[model samples]
Target chain A: MLSSSKVKLIQSLNKKKYRQKYNLFVVEGIKNIKEFVFSNFLISNIYTTEPIPFMQEHQYQIISHEELKKISFLKTPHNALALVELPDTLPYSIQGIQIALDSIQDPGNLGTIIRLADWYGIEQIFCSETSVDVYNPKVVQATMGSLARVQVNYTDLKKLLTTSPIPVCTTDMDGENIYTSCLPQEAFLVMGNEGNGISEDIKSISNLKLTIPRFGKKQKTESLNVAISTGIILSEFFSQKEKI
Target chain B: MLSSSKVKLIQSLNKKKYRQKYNLFVVEGIKNIKEFVFSNFLISNIYTTEPIPFMQEHQYQIISHEELKKISFLKTPHNALALVELPDTLPYSIQGIQIALDSIQDPGNLGTIIRLADWYGIEQIFCSETSVDVYNPKVVQATMGSLARVQVNYTDLKKLLTTSPIPVCTTDMDGENIYTSCLPQEAFLVMGNEGNGISEDIKSISNLKLTIPRFGKKQKTESLNVAISTGIILSEFFSQKEKI
Candidate 1:
């Protein structure tokens, strides 16, 4: 049986402040929990309706479905849910073609970007302080087990871009066509907010500005979704490198 | 002034059965409603909190915000909402690079695909009976404005593939790499369901099988999101054709 306070604490982790205060976030669904279990992330608690063989004897408590429902954040709660310790944010390290985000606010978009980063072999993602929390449950669920693979660091994006050693690449309306641009093997590709493209400050500092040309007959779409833009751009970079 | 029966009709339009019965669907938010107004779609009614300059004087009824909230589907209702006539499904015509969805269950995915097809200049989409309705409010909202440009038809997959004049291209784990493959200018590109990709029946008939190669070091990711995958594949096709 889940205690009222325990249920409250688990539910509170859905918000960023509480997640940071406790340094804990929830991971639900059997597939996602299994990925976290097998990865380096340390699991603090596990609540489930059935036995999870991989979890330690004392790690997970098999609770009734009624008890599980009380603590689950999902509308239709999966078989299991886990409380995981958030990893300490490591110092920013220069890497091959790192993705930089300037206030990407959507958790779903951030999660899809993280999964795309994992697929294309990009190891690190640098996010502005304003970006949505990577530990947000929506992001964790959207990653589809890739949250265990890709590392995301939240930092002051302007400072990072100013000091970066590699060329800063960003997408824009009138920028160089990505198909024709000589994309570097190692660069920082920056994406921006949903409503706005890359902020002017970031765009000014970006050494290479790329654009995905629109082909529609009427050409009315204002912009692509941040995550979809990331996927198409990464495909170009990866295809150019013959990496994927 | 809004009548109780009118509000009831608008609310009922949320369901597929009611939408089919009335041949109408709701278009909310100023941007999407404007797109429908500018397009060939016939508008049945417009309800708004204030006057819309572009709408005909008699077309929109200025209503109170409280009344607007009563009929709006959005969490925060936008400036306006319109009931639009659903276009009759025209007979499927052979087109340049048509998109075929086996059973894309997510409304958001279908919406994004419609928007992406607009961006790439692909005009027609064919979906199986199991696919979500294009008129789904979430989809209509997600499409932004591209719903005006693309056409979607529900048809039998097995029959469509058998009768297609061009090759049917679909992605798989062990297929030819999309980056190096010669993508045809005019073909039916099939993307599948979210969890279980292109059903076996469709897979057996795919003439050209392509794969988006994974380049991650550990490669733990099972697959890309259907929408993201569609973006990457469409990018390759568009780039190869120089359609932009």
Candidate 2:
């Protein structure tokens, strides 16, 4: 049984402003909710059609399916939805191979990149202020529990690139081929917007520029998708590091 | 300038059943339409809100913005939309490094893979019968003009695998590390469904099983997105091929 006020609070998290105001975001589906239960993220509320273990009686609301639907954003609502408290935006302590985003607007792209970063053992991601909000519900759902593992910091990407102590690399059409280049073990890798490559301000300060060579015969493709490029580059970087 | 009958015909192309019945598909956006105009695809009718050069007056209908919105599937309609004649499905011919998809259900994934095939110079893609139709409007939109270059064929993927004349490679969790493997230049790379990867029948016939190494500590991530894995594996294959 869900109270009207509780339902309204869950629904409100869909908007960026509300999420910021409350410092809360929604994570849906049983699998995602289960992953969150074991992670370090603090769970404020759990609403489900069925009782789930590890959820205290007061913390969880065993609501009817209709009530669950009222709060779910999915077309077909998953069995459970959880409200998770957003972690504080801690200062980035750059370690190895940190990712910098230059105004990536798509929630799905940002989410997938975070998951990729988690897979490659990257600890931190620095997003330009214009990038999609990390707490967006769609992004949270897309991350598939990776949001708990990776730390994201929203900041001025241009300034970070200029002040970076290590080598900074960004992709370009005429840049050195990534396949042949010797990428550093520790560096800042910048990926850009879907429509535009890296911003001019950040691109100008980068110490290295790289390109993923096009193998197609006609080679008519404008460029690889930003997220796909990141995967390939990261794979190549680790493959090289492992070889040495 | 579009008649009621013509508008109805254009709008009907959105549905797969209707598209098959009429042998036509919708291609939106000025860049996409221009690519089709230059490619082998025959444009049956083009409806635009503004006059477009290089289009014969009789072949194009100058319609109001409201009329375009009525027929367009996109939330924000582009300047023009074109009805393209579906080319006949030609029999598959063996080629260098083909991609086979088994039950790939997402339109965006199918489309992105097609574009990725175009980028890596893979000329042909074979799809399981249950895979999403390549002509889906969402797919055509996501391809971003690469659909014009890559040839996609829907066929019995199992039969193709059994009869494959070259090495067949598929990704699995416990397979050999892709970095150290000697990937053949001519092969069929099979990527599986988003949730349930490579069907059992297809897996049995594969000659090579490769895995993309996960570098994350604890490695809680189950797997990379299918399309991202495709990019990584394809990059590795071509890079090795180029090395020799």
Candidate 3:
């Protein structure tokens, strides 16, 4: 059972203002809750329809499915919902090949990119301020369990790139082909918005502009999706490093 | 204003039975509708808030925004909606590079792959019958009018792969590294279910099983997303072809 205040607080996290004020974000679905519970991440609270044996170590409440559903953002609520404490703000540190997304507006894209970045062992992702809110229910759901492992920082992309010493790369159609391009091992790979590519100011700061070559005879579609391109780029980076 | 009967009929397209019975599907959004209207697709009807200067050449109705929203499947209704005649069943032709999705459940992934396939000039996509219905309103919206261009067929993947002469290549964790794998210019690339990899029977038919090499120093995420994997594989196919 949940107190009225608890339920209100859980519901409040849906908005960015509440999330920021409370320094907390929502993570839902049985898999995600399990992942967060078992991970090193700190969970402020857990709400579920039934006893989640896996999350026994956390502060939790077994509420009715109807009650859980009320606070769930999904159309079909996953078995569990959790409030995770947002990490204290950390200064940007240019390390291994980190992925920086400039104004990626889609929640699903940002989440999937976080998952993809996690798989490649890239621990940090920086999203432009205009990017979809990471704590948006849709983004949290899309990240699956990867959100537990990846550190996502929302910052002004233009500022970050301009002052960076490491080479910055932006994906574009007219850029040098990615296949033959010499991508540095430790640098920032900037991805652009869904409808628009990288902005001019950001593009100017990009030390290199790369493209994934299209081999098919047809040019029916304008561009490869930003999320899709990230996968191909990450795949090539890993494959290249292994050979060396 | 849309007639009540017409509105009910459009909403019915949400179900599989209604879709097959009417032999029609819906496409929405400003960009999608504009592209869909201009593309070679047959527009059975169009519902809009205002007269589209160019679309005046076609059959359309200027309806209230509320009326347009009534039949819209999206959270935010576009300015227009179009009922398109489902193309005739295509003759299943086996040749060149192909993509097969097994039990994919996400509409967004289904749509993005359709767009990616069109960009790569891949002619056909085969999906396991259990996959999301290609004509689902969400899927149609996400395809960005590429649905009209690509030929999608849903069938039993196990039976199809077993009988087909084309080499079946699948993605797996412990498989050959894709960068060095000599991929056939013409073959069926099998992408598996959202949560599960290729089934045993499908794996049995695979001529090659390869993995996308990960560059991240730490493998933190559970798995690379299926759609992301599909993009990486398609890009590699094009890259290999370009080198040749």
Q: Name the best candidate (by DockQ).
A: 2
lDDT of 2 by residue, B128-160 (tens): 999989998999998888998888898899998
Model 2 misplaced regions, further than 4 Å: A54-58
Tens-digit per-residue lDDT, B19-137, candidate 1: 99999999997778888888888888898888888766788888899988999989999988899999976665787888999999998999999999988877778999999999989
Error of 3 at B166 (Å): 2.7
Q: List the residue pairs that clash in candidate 1.
A: none
**Candidate with maximal lDDT:** 1
Query: Interface RMSD values for the candidates, listed in order?
Result: 2.0, 1.1, 2.1
Model 2 chain B — which ten-residue stretch has the worst lDDT? B215-224
Scored against the true structure, residue A1 in model 2 reaches a CA lDDT of: 70
Per-residue lDDT over A1-244 for candidate 2, one digit per residue giving the tens place of the 0 to 100 score: 7879888888898898999888898999877887777777888888888878766677777888999899998888999898999887776677678899999998889999999999998877999999999888889887887888888898888887788888899999989988888789888999999998788888889899998888887756757788889989888887777667
How are the candidates ranked when ordered by lDDT, highest leading?
1, 2, 3
Each candidate structure's TM-score, on Cα atoms with residue i matched to residue i, is 0.97, 0.96, 0.92
Residue A71 in candidate 2 has what lDDT? 95
Question: What's the CA error at residue B76 for candidate 3, in Å?
Answer: 1.6
Q: Give the runs in model 3 whose Cα sits over 4 Å from its true position.
A: A38-40, A54-59, A216-218, B37-40, B55-58, B214-220
Clashes per model (N, Cα, C within 3 A):
0, 1, 1
DockQ for model 1?
Answer: 0.66
Give the TM-score between model 1's chain B and the true chain B: 0.96
* Chain A agreement with the truth for model 2, given as TM-score: 0.95
